[model samples]
Target: MDHTTAETQLLDAADTLFYERGIQAVGMDAIRAASGVSLKRTYQLFPSKEHLVEAVLRRRDLAIRAELEAYTSARTTPTERILAVFDYLYEWFRQPDYRGCAFINSFVELGAGSENVAEIVRTHKRAFADHIAALVAAADLPPARVGQLLILANGAMVTAAIAGSPEPAREAREAAQRLLDEGVPD
Candidate 1:
């Protein structure tokens, strides 16, 4: 395969392994074997395992952002778009291979002092929150309320991932509906 394809494959493999297992638990050899690429090639693409882990997280963030954008685009109303976010996440949680949030898992695995990984995780999280904030703004909610709603949505995702159940997403959706109704009066 070409260089781009090879790198993509390596990222894909790393994403799966790192998400299912943990960054610390998964080694370069495992990524090479799983990607069907040589160790030399993997090293050439990433230079270090930490870099590879970051690539995996970046790829996942891109994919999820695309999914969320597509989900929001199909609906006419902002409320539908807001509800769609939670609905999409609930479906994601049902995936057979789902093992909770990869970034959260990596954070737990890498511990608190790993600034590099923490930076990547924080960037991805801020992007998600920003997306929610934009959506809330478009819906015309007050700025303070929009920020509060964004926190609630993000907290719901993390809670669901940690709880290993969809209940949090469901309840969060209900709570979100209540908040929106109170704020926007739909």
Candidate 2:
């Protein structure tokens, strides 16, 4: 296969394997096997497992940001837009294979040892916080509310994953609505 196709295949395989299992648990050999790409080709495309993990994270970041944009943009009001984030989480948490946020998972697994992994996770989280900030500002809510919403959303992600239930998203959404209600003028 061509370079681009092979790279994509390797990335897709790596992303799935890492997310489902973990960065340390899944070796380069497994990624090569799952991608159906030869070991030499996988190494040629990624150079190292670190490079491959970074690529998979970067790819996932782009996809998740795009999905968040689409989900929030579809709402009619600022409150709806903000609440939609939790709604999105609810759907995601409901997925049969849902484990949790990949960024958080990766960070927990490698943050202390790998600066690259930690930085990637931090950047992804910062982007998510920025998104929440924009939504809060658009709603004319207090700036401090940005942190509140972020905490709620993040807490729900972890909670739902641990409990193996989507209810945390619903609970978070309800709390978010209250936060908006307190600030909003009707």
Question: Whose lDDT is greatest here?
Answer: 2
Q: List the residue pairs that clash in candidate 2.
A: none
Against the hidden true structure, what lDDT does model 1 obtain? 0.81
Worst 10 residues of 2 by lDDT: 177-186
**What would the TM-score be for candidate 1 when compared with the true structure?**
0.90
lDDT of 1 by residue, 60-135 (tens): 8888899988988798998878877878778887777777788777787774867888888888888888888888
Q: What tens-digit string does per-residue lDDT give for candidate 2 at 36-103?
A: 99999998888999999889999999999999999999999988999999999999999998989999
Badly placed stretches (over 4 Å) of model 2 are: 184-186
Question: Cα lDDT of all candidates, in order?
Answer: 0.81, 0.92
Q: What is the lDDT of residue 17 in candidate 1?
A: 86
RMSD of 2: 1.7
Return the number of clashes found in candidate 2.
Answer: 0
